[model samples]
Target: MREMTIGKNDAGQRLDKFLQKALPSLPPSLMHKYVRLKRIKCNGKRCQTSDRLTEGDVLSLYINDEFFQPVKEEEAFRRITPRLHILYEDDHILLCDKRPGMVVHEDDQGTLDTLINHIKAYLYEKGEWDPDKEQSFTPALCNRIDRYTGGIVMAAKTAEGLRVLNEKIRLHQVQKFYLCLVHGTPSPRQAVIQDTLLKDSKQNQVRVVKKNTPGARTASMSYKVLQSRGKLSLVECELFTGRTHQIRVQLSHRGWPLVGDTKYGTMERNRPYGMTHQALYSYKLHFSQEGDWGELSYLRGKTFQVEDVPFLPFFYNQPKN
Candidate 1:
């Protein structure tokens, strides 16, 4: 028999959901059976599987000791040396500047040194996270950037933080700004590009298309030419709708291919710069004042930005304000 007390991080989860996370060895069928048999009780009383747990609630499990034993798995983060460029951090969240070539999560390549892993390692070393103590929750990234595109990625330190930030992002309450160097200056310095995009999963690419096309979705972004040097132009873009490679595909369709973007631009255009990956960076983030942020209320109306972008120095000696 074992008793567990719900903490703030573990609250608000359904009884069945909590059981599945707290006792991975227990089969789902058996768990339901146990609940029916009064083997599981909340506050010493029988509880339903759908009952939501709250902070300070206690759960008593009258089951086999074997089910409580922890599962053995490789914790790859332990072996990785944490390397992160922190832009902002608080008790509920963290903003990390992920560099190019770093995978945000594990991919087909079986890479171990990933951005999330580094975050875990960093938090573990700081004593903010312990996998053994957490039955279900782990530090998680709220958004993801491509492996080649460097940017500021948000990490949630708590379950409530993750839920709130995800909702804000979905509602377009969180604004994201990006910087990229393109081969040619945009004719109309500033404008919004709106079009439907169809993605080819097999090819891992996207293309602009007419509306109502099969599997096509709307994509939009507003961009401005910040500076012009020779034939290249520095552009700042804000995403109105996030599609797969939306900025790259939309701009390239309008004859303004991003520098070093071999997938969307001609080899001759990228060869002059001797570049491989696209010169794009998610440099700034702003949180809207409208909405209930829960524990993350402090982040409302706040803005965080990355000062140094890897490709920015090469284009201009002085930094852009």
Candidate 2:
């Protein structure tokens, strides 16, 4: 028989989970079969798969020694070192300043050019995540920005961190702010706008629709001008609801299309820079919580911000409002 002791990181996890991590080569089918046959035990007593493990617990296995041999993890994936700019990092989460045109998740082409994989690779090098030691608990992103937008995105380093932050986001306790450059000055500069937006998945576009329009969802956001020059205005936007291309579609529908927006913007107006994508940035994030957040409680009442990209220098030089 073979024996192993649980550590802090492995504590509080399920018996099956710890076993999977400890014995990566053991297939789930065989692992369950062994457990059923009393081939696995904790402290010399048969244990259930759902039993939670604790530090110092001595687990023993009567299974064959061959099941202990796991596959070589490093051979599975080559490490990647993308041009990642880190803004804030703690034991629980990592906040990165993502560059423009980088997709957060892969597209239809199955491209791996995503921020999540980049983050994973970074952690792997630091020995934070290892397939040799971990079965399925990989670091994940808590929030995502569009491919063309540049700004702060949160990455959860642990499963507990993911759960806490996602709860805060679900309850609207997490506030996200963006900086966007639009073509015209919106009337009533500061106001929350609500409209129905219908998305065309086939074309990857969304349009503002009438009330009760079928397949349309309600979208709401508040915006105010920070600076303006001639026809271009720098706007600060806060989203109350998230939808596909919500900010881009909503602002464009109001006649103030984004500076570099090719879809809903004008070609004649985009001539100056020969730009292809809209100039939008997710610049800041504010967190507030009253109750338990587990590992993320430290984030409560804190704000993380990133400076405006080439936009501030690029837009500030324009004639002032």
Candidate 3:
């Protein structure tokens, strides 16, 4: 028999769900049978499978030892060399400057060198995270940026931080600003682009459509041309809707495709710039003061920005007015 005490990260989850994560080797049927047989108890009393776990609750498991063995993948983070460009960090959250070409999570290609793994490794080294002590929670990213797009990404060190951050983002209480170099200067210089976006999953691309189709979603963003070079322009965009590739697709539809964007803009057009990946960066983030963020309340009305964008100086050096 073994007893596990619920911590803050492990609380607020159902017993069955927590069991699934804590004892992956335990068969579902057997787990249910154990609960029915009073083999699994909460605080020394019989507990239901659907019972929501609370902090300070103790779970007594009369199961076999084999079910407690950790999986190999749980130790993968320890093998990785932590490479992080952290912008800000607190007890609850961390902000990182992800460089272009680094993936936030593992893709279909089965790459191990990912941003989250590096973060996990960093936390493990600092004694902030221990997989053995955790049942269902791990340090997780609150937001994701494209693999080829450099930007600021937020990570949550605690489960409450993740929940609050996700809620704020869903309510549009968190504002994101992006910087991109486009092929041509926008005629109006500043305007909000509103359109429907349809994503083609097979092609891994999105297109701006005239109307809402079956799978299309409304996309909106306001952009301002900050500087203009010979044939290229530096643009700052603020997203009102978080659609996939909304800025890229909408800007391309407006004849201002991002520089080095081979999918939306011609490769021949990008050849002059010698950039294979799109010149886009999520440079700034702001947390709106209006929302109640619970533990993350201290972050309200705060703005964090990345000062140095790799593509900025090159475009800003151009002589064109």
TM-score of each: 0.92, 0.80, 0.93
Off by over 4 Å in 2: 1-77
Error of 1 at 21 (Å): 2.7
Better of 2 and 3 by lDDT: 3
**lDDT by residue for model 2 over 1-321, one digit each (tens)?**
988887655677899887787788899999898888889989888889999988789888999989778766533224566557899998888999999988887678776768888888788888887755654466888888888888999988876778688888888888999999898898888989999999999999999889999999999899998878867899999988878888999999988999888888889888885667888989999997676777777888999998647577778778776
1-321, model 3: which lDDT tens digit per residue? 999999999888899998998888888999999999999999999999999999999999998899888655645677898999999999999999999999999888988899999999999999999887788898999889889999999999988888889888889999999999998889899998799989999899998766848888999999999989989999999999888888889999989999988889998788988887999999999999996788888999999999789998889777786
- Ranking of models by TM-score: 3, 1, 2
> Which lDDT values do the candidates have, in the order given?
0.91, 0.83, 0.91
RMSD of 3: 2.0
lDDT of 1 by residue, 1-321 (tens): 889999888898899998888888999999999999999999999999999999999989999999988778789999988999999999989999999999999988799999999999999999999997887788999998888999999999988888898899999999999999998889899998899999998898999998899989999899999998877899999998878888899999999998999889999988978878999999999999997988888998999999899998778843333
At residue 185, candidate 1 shows an lDDT of: 83
Clashes of each: 0, 0, 0
